[model samples]
Target: MEDRNNNNNEIYALIIGAGISGIVLARLLAEKNQKVLIIEKRNNIGGNCYDYIDKNGINIHKYGPHIFRTDNGKIWQFLSRFTAWHEYKHKVRAIIEGKEIPIPVNFTSIDTLFDTTKAKVFKEKLISKYGKNEKVPILELKKTDDKDLRELAAFIYEKVFYHYTLKQWDLKPEELAGDALARVPVYTSYYDGYFTEKYQAIPQNGYTKMFENILNHPNIKVQLNTDFKDLKNTKYKYLFYSGPIDEYFNYRLGALPYRSLNFEFKTLPQKQFQSVAVVNYTSKEPFTRITEFKHFFNQKIGQTTVAYEYPAAFELNKNERYYPIPKQENEQLYKKYLQLAEKEKNIYFIGRLGEYKYYSMQSAIAAIFELVKKIAT
Candidate 1:
């Protein structure tokens, strides 16, 4: 990799924000023998997926918990070259009515929340209508004709999703886009796992180290503590931006709304803090969830680190943008910026912030795969 300098005459691509999208694209372009320069406002790469081993020998996710799960074999294989897998399946629990139950309102969750007979009836009704192992969206479940099923839906919606959505996005479930609310579905079976992807695991070492391997190429250069606006005169064949599209245009139209997060990390002396890796505080808690980092890879350590995630409004120059608010007006405003982006040549807006869409880690990489295929061809 080249050293940090203002020289850009030999650069073929300039990627802003050294997140997963930027680093992956840089690696891909470098493989094609194209000179790529990545500028990041932060000193580190991996963005929200960044993780590091602390003194207690626990791999702590700096932002929050990131579990890599993908159905796409090609995308998984692409990342497999960088690091070995830990082979982990994440399980999450949410506190509802002072009892810990599996999220997505699974069969076990139903049993824990409801009486034996009622839980049996609810499960039977759900299976009769949607079939076993089918994941039903909370909203779609509410549309059922059966009164008992509708009652169960109401119970799950109120206990599991309603307050959680409000705390996470500062908006009610109905206010946000349908896709956002559908992410956490009602599982019809006894599956207690958080995700149902074919491949679910974490990097054996860490995300940062894997990213280091990805960026360890001769043609790729990384410049830390550098913003794209500072490189006004640098010349590049193409520009791939992963930062907020509104900020790229200096918010000339208007600042796009986003949700930010603040984490209170604590290293507990005990062997375990929670039974599961993550526990959502669904009711009456200011913070959304508490993540136990040691469970990601089951690292055998005496000390465990947990992060208390508190959602907040995205303030300029205050905190990092985590989630883009998925309201209709926000999408319409994003389109305005998209129009301006289309007019620019050799420039592509990729990833969550750039596209103004909520993307899982796999989805982000999948989007980049398509972008690289189009550009490389």
Candidate 2:
């Protein structure tokens, strides 16, 4: 529970971004009686998971909607220390063939899409082949040669995942690695929740307040609008960098590929905009989905805030890098950066941007926990 440990020669660890990875590592180091300084490029912290109460009295995620869900007890317990959580179950529906149906195209979604007899038959066939209540990847479903399964797969792929993938990543399924297609899965049950993790909820107050609580320790010093390059000449015993890994070494080998996003916010006078928190347009819509922010916490407010998500290619100094493109070439290029990072004992690459992987919020926290455990040992 100690804040600032004054015995570490005045300079202990310098953490390069005040995002979840940075903050968690800073708090861990601070607890170990080490002083930590955090520098952030933007005026605020929290990285892509940042959320705040907007001017219209609605909590809006500056990035897209980030619903916290994880099966790891360690990650949940670590985050629970900072803030109370809203135990809200999130359900996502997609507008397909002019009907709003549950995503992953569950049994209910199938019923909604097909006629009664056909839906029942398809359900029976799916159960006979894969068993009930099992989650199957769309590609796996397409692997079947049964005409009925083929029809079912075609419908779901064309209406649920295919166009959506194209819109979200701007790449066909064939172009990317096999793991990329696993992002979307088909549920063989009536379950409608977007996530199947053991724990799923949102921070009660908002992400910002929770982050503030974590970084409030006297040992953790935070400086806003601070660039890492400006403080490059300054030295610390340890530097946990959570910024882009390639950018850290000035893209010495080559710039790793990434996907950014453009978020558009709208405040409507009505209490609710959509039935569900998120509604995906699986068609060739320019924008992917619309999120009604209030649903995250079930906030009782007169007006509702909604955000439209548009995926864009990551450009230098343009949009924020949200996702690392998971392809063979990109992974190979990242490995090259990893080799470079291995040589720098003073700097440790941390988090999504730094590691060049799409680590979920909980995943990032867990990774930080492991990193600090190693430091402690």
lDDT of 1: 0.90
Count of clashes, each model: 0, 1
Runs with alpha carbons beyond 4 Å of true place in candidate 2: 1-9
lDDT of 1 by residue, 255-362 (tens): 999999999999988999999899999986999999998888787778889999999999999999999898899999999999999999889998888998888889
Q: Sum up the clashes in candidate 2.
A: 1
Per-residue lDDT of model 2, residues 1-377, tens digit only: 22344674565889999888999998888878788899999999998888888887788889888889999998889889999998988899999878999987899999999999999999999999999888888888898978999999998988888888898888877677847787678888899988899999889888999999999897888989999998756557788899999999999998998988898888889999999889998898899999998887777888998989999999998878888987889999999999999998767899998999888888898889888777666
Model 1, runs deviating above 4 Å? 1-9
Question: TM-scores across all candidates?
Answer: 0.96, 0.96
lDDT for residue 317 in candidate 2, whole number 0-100 = 88
